[model samples]
Target: MKTTLQRIGMILFMTGFVFSVCAQEMEVTGTVYDAHDKSPLVGVTVQVKGTQNGTVTDVNGRYRIKVEKGNTLSFSYIGYLVQEIKVNKLHLDVYLKPDKVALEEVVVVAFGTQKKNAVAGSVMRVADQSYYLPSVIFPYPREVNTEEYEAFKENRFLSTIQHPLSTFSLDVDGASYSNIRRMINQGQMPSKDVVRVEEIVNYFSYDYPQPSDGYPVRIVTETAVCPWNKKHNMVHIGVKAKEIPSETLPVSNFVFLLDVSGSMFSANKLPLVKASMKLLVNNLRPKDQVAIVTYAGAAGEVLPSTSASDKQKIMEALDNLQAGGSTAGGAGIQLAYKIAEKNLVKGGNNRVILCTDGDFNVGVSSLTELESLIESKRKSGVFLTVLGYGMGNYKDNKLQTLAQKGNGNHAYIDNLQEANKVLVNEFGGTMYAVAKDVKLQVEFNPNFVNAYRLIGYESRLLNDEDFNDDTKDAGELGAGHTVTALYEIVPVGVDVPVGNVDKLKYQQTKNDVSLPKFADSKELLTVKLRYKEPDKDVSRKLEVPVLANRMNLNASQDFNFAMAAAMFGQLLRNSDFKGDAEYSDVIRLARKGLGNDPNGYRHEFIRLVEAVEQLEK
Candidate 1:
């Protein structure tokens, strides 16, 4: 009996010990600050040493994480020395010192050099009549030639009597908005050609109903008075792709084709890319596989395809990368695609993610050559995603062309928050395609409308004949992706003068046959869409007719917000069609339509508009 009692006492002692150990794994809180000025540093990455668990510091420099009593916590920030400390208590504060070697680099202005430390009080002016603050040392001015953009004509109004059909591919890219934001933040207006109106409009999320039927996509349309031209009507078309849960998504085989060229040496380029890729790697499932391929003067594989379960190995490979040599973008693409094909997963998501500044200057560097190569490889069922980073000599045009032709999406990561938005928050939509070759063709009823013009999508306009051609490639729709398009319309009764054309003497003119009798009815226009399943070659068609019912600008939050976005784009482009639209009008409308901005993107848009207003003044 005494021995039995001793055994019970022993068991109780062990239980207490176990409970004490478990209690030690409690929450840890900390704050990170700059060592020089003791200012709070935002976006500092805080992670438990030797673990995948991590979190970024808040705007106030505060961070909270869970760790054991003896576990070590590591804090890292760009341009700052990394700090690691053992955790004994719940609260910790760390001050990070700026890397002197990195900070001592000369600040290059048009005239002379300034010490990086002295840049805080100096202003530098370039030959283009733009001023910059030298204090933002990371994205230093490049020694290369000024960046170039392709000049393209904007879409013009078309008389419905002459051309009744408007067809184009759906663009889901949002690169231009972020790129323009970078320029504006740098105290300059972006060049006119850099503003892609369609990209700006599609950047924001719209609230549209999901598909009730089994179709992969849904169409939502509304018409309201045009804010720019009150005499005309604005039609908003939203295409919403069905959302699939991440757990149910097919296995992903990703090849991270990173550019380690000399141009990518900037803080915002390679370092930011590495941090961004780490976030993605942390979120990856064990079933997913990743491979790292890097290019400079030449292309080579840094890591073979491996399961995501071994995240430490993947991250070690990424951390070992350093920037140098010239850019061989074409060779990098070939090798990445080859590796992707070799490890392609059947009935799965296979893609090559290209992170670069888009400055390709070595062999086969021309835009045409790269586009051809990407076009050829896209047939292998491996997609591409072009992520542009850095500034100075960024090649937006080349990166955009590659994404367009390579069955992929394009995004510019200007900062770490933007990276989280693209890679973490919108992971499924950015990485998984639900439909490919999605094309839209709208036929306006001449009896109800006199003239009409697509507000954006100038670069995605497709030939009318290409709409039905299955061989023609087009934009892709990812899971839970929302695409918005706007059209300015002139109703038949509106007294607007349109350009007149000479009658064709070779053709007979029949008014009754040309104009549909049903136009006077509720039917305003017919929207026809064609898309193919991700792995299929055959395309499926869906059509829906829009009603002539007119809605007030305040009728729906989506309508108002979408119109505001469109107006903002037009103002930025300095579009000729902008009538009475001003930046103030955009601000007022946007505020009212900002419904449940959980992600704060709408609020960011409002801020962007305010900035542009100040710039305009």
Candidate 2:
């Protein structure tokens, strides 16, 4: 009895000791303000010195962090001098001073109805001029030119007899389109390397029917006379993914991976990023959950998983982010994916929505390393959403690589209006996926075609055999998304400027071996598509034979619009295959294709062409 009583006393003593330690760790609440303007500064990083534990100032410049006794806290913000203070009491306030030299390094130019001559007599070195209403114009006065894009050669027409099968992945990403749009609107011609013709054409939705055969995606095919060259025909392939109602959409487990590097301090960068994030948060369902992870020279999680119902808290987290330090993109991604996996919502939408300028100067910055890291994470069934921002030093190649490897989508947010389009208006299509690893393989028939070339998708091309391999990663189809692909065809009797393949000893013709099942059919081409259910490993197949259609003078508006976009992209890149493509032709096709454009996006495209025409003159 005496020993039992002594054991109970020891247990009580240990419990009391634990309670005392917990009591000593107090919640420190504080507000950060700019010393110059005396305004509440949003996105101030409030962190415990020498540790990863930190929090960001919210929309109101308020931050709350639990700190142990005698722990020092560091406050940092972009273009602001850092301040460190010891945590003593429950309440604390911080005032940060702006660093003038740092401010000068980041040029702030006028935008959205502002004059070309902006702050501090900075005449934005524009290549052309016509301010787009949705504006994000900043001059790289310091470095002058730093934007990066992967260079790729245009696809060439192949002899139908030698190369009958053309396989490539399907993509719904619109980053290339918007990024170029920003360049053109900023009075600069988008470099050829940055112009992705497929992305440009697929940016706009076509009047294709959704899935009705119990599958998540449907295939629609059409034919029209090539707008650029009447002698050459164009085949239009449209894939429309089924749409789910917003209310019935799967619960989302989102981790907002943000780059808070010094490069993102410009108005159109970090500030725009915060605005864009808020737009997405507004569309989140009550049952959805969100967390935030930030990276500068190092990576840290600023917010833990919190219910979307607590939207105010989420917005606060976004507001508290400010940019400073070098970019650690790889570390940020790793930390974000880890947190997302930890809070995985089984059988639901699990994603890491990374918003960055795509600059990675610090640890794990190599493309090969990031690719391997993302490849491993893709097996975890977590989707990725990459949102590119900023211009000077923007890493387009890295962003595209990450998106493709992760089986995710990419978009560029230039302004608040664009943010609304992607995050609010098109919320369902941008955030949720219905089909994963979508790929298309086209077998052109020699009987109907002499030569053929896929209009775009040079970067998405795949080995023909990879179509059957479920392990190969490909682009994903989001809910309510429509992906459009075009093929330039030279009919059997028609001829175009292209090369012929040399006869090979091992080559086996249809007569030498055996004819394909559809070789004798009247089909112009056979399109075989493969896609996996978002949660599955094995893929399902859909095959459709497209019958040849003689050139049509009256093509559908959807086809016309897509053709216009294709022609515009080709002309911009000065593609050798652009035969007779002209700005006037782009304007004409775009005008004719402006059917039921409630959002006025088509009309805007027409105006953009006019602007480019003026630039050429």
Candidate 3:
């Protein structure tokens, strides 16, 4: 009888345990807001404590997630204090305070700001000083200095008579545009160095006709009145890469070279990277493979190359990552390349996706050293995609150099929305390269155009001789990628002083060289493009001549929008060439030319311009 009673008690206990377990697993919903302003915080990360399962706040700052009643939910934003709430109730609202300590401890610098503790001699005491020091203390501003940018000299107008051929590698990176938007939204103007005109102009998608022919790329050219300078005409050159369907794309072998160093401990750095990687992993196909390689003080492969079919396993590995040690970026690069090459898919998309804050402190940290390392790895037929995160002490120059040398594209991820745009919506273009070693050479007709200046390719400018050299490495064009270049041209009859060069008394006044009759007729310039197949070493050349037909600035929405973006960049950089280009003009042109902004990127850009104008006022 006693044994029977004990069995009944055990049965009841087991049933209760099952009920408890089921009760604990419930759906939790919440809204996150700013403590001071009570405003909804968009893109705030809400994750289950000690787990990778998380969801970001929607436009209204509302989030829903399934979690155990006993588990905790962590709410984190870039500049806000992290908040944790016990999941005891079904609905929980969280108000996160701004992290005042971080804001007060930052020191503003010319190029960028640095943390007070990071700056040398920033906290020196009076005891260490030999001379009297005056101390003036003021209330710390809420702003934190987190932006880092490199200053570049603006391109000046070149006389076609002196230099007729303009050569440059194509650029498809769009990081600068997003980064500038972030600054403008924060009610601050981005530093001059952070504004790359080419990146801004190329950020938007253009309606260039795709190559229906056997060629891998198509070139389109148009000319219109320059928006910035009415006296000068703007030449628009667009390159459209052939679009390839995702299913038909070659199998992918991707190595995620993640930086989990101590510097990446911020909410926006390592945590955001993991979130971004999760988005990418979810988008992977069954035929694709991924490997996780991390660097922190030392480099090691955390997850071996695994098929994308096992997404849960990959996500588990990503969730287990924790940031701590110093960065060994160079070692990490070497190991990642080694793994990628080992599992390389022949005739497939092989690439390394580097997610970091660009803070390389340990071995092989210099920009030149990192460039050499990446350049060496590029020869292995593996491309790179650099996704920069965070801001304080960001090595923008270093990251740009590495991406350029690695034959890859670069982007800055400021939020989950950007991650989705880059890793999810544009996955094919971000991963698969349609053509490699793409270079552009424009030969201006000395008769139709007296002088011309190519804008916003200073870093990519190549020597005229380098155009014909097959061994020279240039930029890579991804599937469905569109690249645009703008040239401010001076007509032959325009009387513009071309930098006032001294007349060479030793040479003939005008060489008796015969000029092509078409040069004086309608041919304004010749556009020549050289690109190689993804797997080939030799390049194929395409050439087209642009006529001297000039149209009104309102010729087409594409033309107007392109020129507006270029003018915006010039205004941001305070280029001397930007004559009478006001913020009002930019807003007017951008709003009118915002064609079918399905993704709303163009509309967002227009809003940013308006915001900047308000801030300037």
Candidate 4:
């Protein structure tokens, strides 16, 4: 009995010792992040609340510091708002909001600078410091052949571009109405009441030059046998815009003319727009400017011009913008233009960025009225960039016209990544118009080319007469921009899509054997481009050519990349020209042609395409 009691006492003493040792030691660990992008933030200050003991975040925004079990932790960064958290567990997730007054919240406004508080209108600004893969477009769709497609999958090339190449048209529905004029003049005629699809796509991206020094953005361009008409070749081109840092690059005057009409009440409409705007706001720097102008039955500047420095005021204005009443797009445009004119700044970035579901229902609803209104104000030195959001009953037609006549660009935001792509990843190129009144003319050589069809740009084809007219307005290009076009050529011996004359009509045709015969023209297509510096009234010309040949679709990466883009566009619009095009085939070609995906935009596109397919189902 005595021996047993002694053993029990010893056990108690050891147990108590163990407990004391454990109580004396505690671990505090957590992951820190930059509030802007939930990306891990390194170099942040982490300290015990009210105590001097603290540690900085490591490379991955991770930290481990010894502290009392119940000690509160304070997290801080130079440009971010500080945060306090209780240490409940060893592993924790900490997010730090941006500092409201530290670095000026830069908002890109039209032509000037304003404190965030003074700016009026629904404005979204973004600041991203990440990198995305570069988007490389095939010079022409026929660059790819089957052999190259196979080679791309075998690690033959280090990188490749994605699909859905950029397309911009001033008139949304102009593709169907002005084909002949567009082909000659390189300018699509204005449509009365329809939206142009290409303009919507072109509005967001700037024409930044390809990264010449770094890894060249690789792309597979291809031409394939048209599934519906084997007599013609289908060209595909792919593009992927690389991501870079978000910093104090340029100051822009941004007027957000939002459409809050009753038609935009759908879940994806106003709500998505608001969210998108917020994301952009969170990205602003203190040096930028922004304003909010909303149109619903009437147009009003809810917030005056303000600097990005005052975020609270800017955010408050954004929060106050509500959706109601009919859409008075013209009124909104006029007010926005007025605000822009008053705040015009020379040599600085000036642009009004409009966000809408493309639905305009109320006053001055005609496209002509809106276009004329926009055109008159464009001379005031402010440019336009249109962002189309939401779906269903969308008025793409009007938005396209506004962009074309206003000397601007257009884009469609379907998801958050795309929102980032436009607002954060590529802000400068999107908001700053480096070149204006841009036009493209491709003169085909009748000698070498038997027949040819320009795949897209049905609306952008221009008349030769309009080329030199300074009064004629055209598409605008931003800094470092690239423009691509595709032509499906039909050789003399091949049966092409060109219509055949009736046998009876041909029988009556006299075979005139002219004594003077000329050699067949060797030129395939002559591409002539005219553009003006953003602030200039004159135009400059650049010329290139589309060579004639039976291009191996798989032999060239450019060919594959281009075809993929064309097919993707066809899928999006479901064009009447698609005939027998299939999404499955698009996927197959893209998979075989996809090369090094640095930014994952191509991968995301594939997912988007799949999602679209599912929705179709």
- Residue 424 in candidate 1, Cα distance off native in Å: 0.6
Q: TM-score order of candidates, best first?
A: 3, 1, 2, 4
Q: How much RMSD separates candidate 3 from the native structure?
A: 7.9
Over 4 Å off, model 1 = 1-145, 509-521, 550-553
Q: What is the lDDT of residue 524 in candidate 2?
A: 92
Question: TM-score of model 4 relative to the true fold?
Answer: 0.61
Local accuracy of candidate 2 as per-residue lDDT tens digits, 1-617: 99999999999999999878755888899899999988998656677777655656755687778789678998876558778898888999999998664333333232432332233334233322322222122222234346678889999998887789999999898888888777665555676888899999987878799799799999988887888888888998999999898899889999999999988876567867886787688878899999999999999999999999999999888877878999999999999999999999999999999999888999888789888889989988789999998776788889998999997789987656667788877877888899999999999988888889998899999999999999888889988999999999999888745764555588666434465544466789999999999889999999998887545668899999999999999998889989888899999989889999987788878988886775565
Q: Least lDDT summed over 10 consecutive residues: which range in candidate 4?
A: 148-157
Task: State each model's CA lDDT, in order.
Answer: 0.83, 0.82, 0.82, 0.55
- Candidate 3 residue lDDT tens string, 41-122: 8778787877656667754677777898888898876557778888888999999998776444543333344465465534
**In model 1, how large is the Cα lDDT of residue 103?**
33
Models, CA RMSD each: 11.2, 12.2, 7.9, 18.6
Tens-digit lDDT track of model 1 for 1-617: 99999999999999999878865787888789999999988667777777645656654677777788888887876568778898888899999998765433444443354554565534332223433434333224335435557777788889786789999999999998898876655444565688888898899888888876798899888888887787889888899999999889999999999999988876567867887798789889999999999999999999999999999999899878888999999999999999999999999999999999999988879988988888999899998899999776778889989999999999999877788888888888899999999999999987788889898888899999999999999999988999999999998888644676576688855343674454355678899999999899999999989877656555478778888888887887788887899999999989888998998999989988886675455
- In model 4, state the lDDT of residue 468: 66
TM for every model, in the order presented, reads 0.81, 0.78, 0.82, 0.61
lDDT of 4 by residue, 511-551 (tens): 13533343355544455556676778987665554455645
Clash count, one per candidate? 0, 4, 1, 105
Worst 10 residues of 3 by lDDT: 132-141
Better structure of 1 and 2 per TM-score: 1
